[model samples]
Target: MDATTLALLIGAGLVGGACNAVAGGGTFFTFPALLAAGVPPVAANATSAISIWPGHATSLFGYREELRRHAGRLKSAAPAFVLGSLIGAWLLSVTGNGLFRQLIPWLLLAATVLFAIGPRLRSWIAPTGSGTLPKPVIFLIDLLVAIYGGYFGAGLGILLMAVLTLIGLSDVNEANAVKNALATIVSSLAVAVFIVTGIIAWGPGAAVLAGAVAGGYLGARFARWINPRILRAIIIAVGLGLSWIYF
Candidate 1:
């Protein structure tokens, strides 16, 4: 990549990591930066996944207690995470560029809309308890969302939050923790798929990874000091701005 593209990737990675650390829309920045850096659609998506996987991994630290307490549930959710991710990555690999491009605007729009509705959706989906939804239903929902994560993943955290919220799941922090943990699993599985299939653009992905790590670390360190509502507004603006670029 040229200096310009490298800068773009790094800048996007920085902001993307901070965005996710603050709220939940890093892909809104990273994916578009990959595309702007001239990576193909499917490859950009794969590389974007690879770039952010580490941040997801690091996010698990905050919820260690919850993860430990809910070990059994986490174990129960693993199969769906792996299976759904593999299937979604496979679907992405087979997608034609033309079709994928056509879908970009719509996908961005969907993610934006989801982000807009995040607060309300969270309230609506707030879990009542385990008895609220059957295991099978929860599994099915997880599998479907994992599939989507494997494919695109821009608004995945929001989707997971909504689903986990609906099952009358655990506390807010626990739900967020579970979401990051599952994201780590599913994104890792999908990364494996992209690696085996050779769809990833290692160069840009590596650049973004470096920046993402730095950004994630800084964001985590300063999370309490930062205004998430401000970061969220920036993401909303970027999401809207990027939608037009793909068109």
Candidate 2:
């Protein structure tokens, strides 16, 4: 890759990792950069998933206590989550770059909207008084969320958080814990699929991976001084700008 493309990919990954570490929505940066660097749309999606996913790991570790408490749910939800991810990843692979390219603008827009409305969606969907949802519903929700997570994963956290809250996990931390785990599963499985299919762009992916790691570390270390609201605004603006350009 040319120096400019390398710079773009690394810069996007850095900003994206920081955005995710501070607020969320790292895909808002990396996906657009991948496309600009001439990665095919479907390939870019897979690369983005792997590149941005490391940032979510810290959040998962931070919520291990909550994860332990919800261990039972993970057992029941695993089958559906894994299956959905497989199907979604296969779907994207089959979609090829052409159809996925057409869908990129819309998908990004949807992700932005979902991210923007996450809190409101949680309040609207989740009853104030409720316990963990029934297994059947949990599996169904997990299935759906996993599919989307494997598909693109842009705002999967918000979607997972909303579903977790709606299913009656009252503690925000608890819900986030579950969301992060399932999201990890989804992305992990998707990465496996992408790797097997040889669609992941190694050069860009490596650039993004290195940048994201550094950015995540920096963002977390300095999180106390960072204004998440500003990061959130930056993500929103970038997402909207990419959508406008792509459309």
Candidate 3:
């Protein structure tokens, strides 16, 4: 790759990782960067997944205490994440580029809408006097979200946050911690598939990975200080914008 393409990938990764740490939607940055750098569409999508996977680990470090408190919850959620991710990744491996391309905008729009409605949806699901949703219901939700994350994870964090909230996780940072943990599982499983399928572009993936680690750590540390309302607005706007462009 040329120096310019390398620089672009690194820059995109940095921004993408920080975005994921803050409010999700990182793929809006990384996926397009790869496509612009001349990678094939399927390869770019696979490489994007692998590139951003490590950021969740660094982001998790910033939420260690929260993670500890929620260890059992994460453990219970793991199997669904694993199974769903494998299914999604397998689907991606078999998808033709033309079909995948046609699906992109719709997927982004749906994820964006889900993120926008998440809090309200959670409130509706567990209105006053009602307890948190049942464990089985939560598990089903996580499985569905994990499948999407494995396929195209731009707003996976927000979707996971919604699931965590439905389980009665009130603290934003704590919810983010759980979100990152589950995301790690989803992406790791998907990446393993991508690796086996030989769809990832290692040269670009490495460049993005390097920047993502640093950005992820820093973004996580700063996340708590930011106003959640404003962050969500920015993320929503970005998601809408990206969806529009893709359409």
Each prediction's Cα lDDT score? 0.75, 0.72, 0.84
- Candidate 2 has a TM-score of 0.77
Q: How do the residues 113-184 of candidate 2 rate in per-residue lDDT, one tens digit apiece?
A: 655565566566544634445678778878887888788766565556556646666454455457667777
Ranking by lDDT: 3, 1, 2
Candidate 3 lowest-lDDT run of ten: 158-167
> Which residue runs of candidate 2 sit more than 4 Å off their true CA positions?
21-23, 102-128, 170-173, 217-247
Which prediction has the highest TM-score against the true structure? Answer: 3
Q: Which residue pairs show backbone clashes in model 1?
A: 127-168, 128-168
Best by lDDT: 3
Tens-digit lDDT track for model 3 on 1-247?
A: 9999999999999988988887787888899999998899888999999998888878988999988999999899988999999988988888899998898888777777877777777788778836478888878988898888887777677677666766777667777788888988999999999999988899989999888888788878988887867766765787787789789
lDDT of 2: 0.72
**How many clashes would you count in candidate 1?**
2
In candidate 1, position 94 carries an lDDT of 96
Runs in model 1 deviating more than 4 A are 104-131, 221-247
Question: Model 1: per-residue lDDT, tens digit, 1-247?
Answer: 7898899898888877766654556887899899888888889999999998888777666557777977887898898888999999999999988887787667666656666565555555544422355679779978988898898777676566556656655344555567778888888999999999999999999999988877765555454454545544554565666567667
Please list the Cα RMSD from the true structure of every candidate, rounded to 1 decimal place: 3.5, 3.7, 1.6
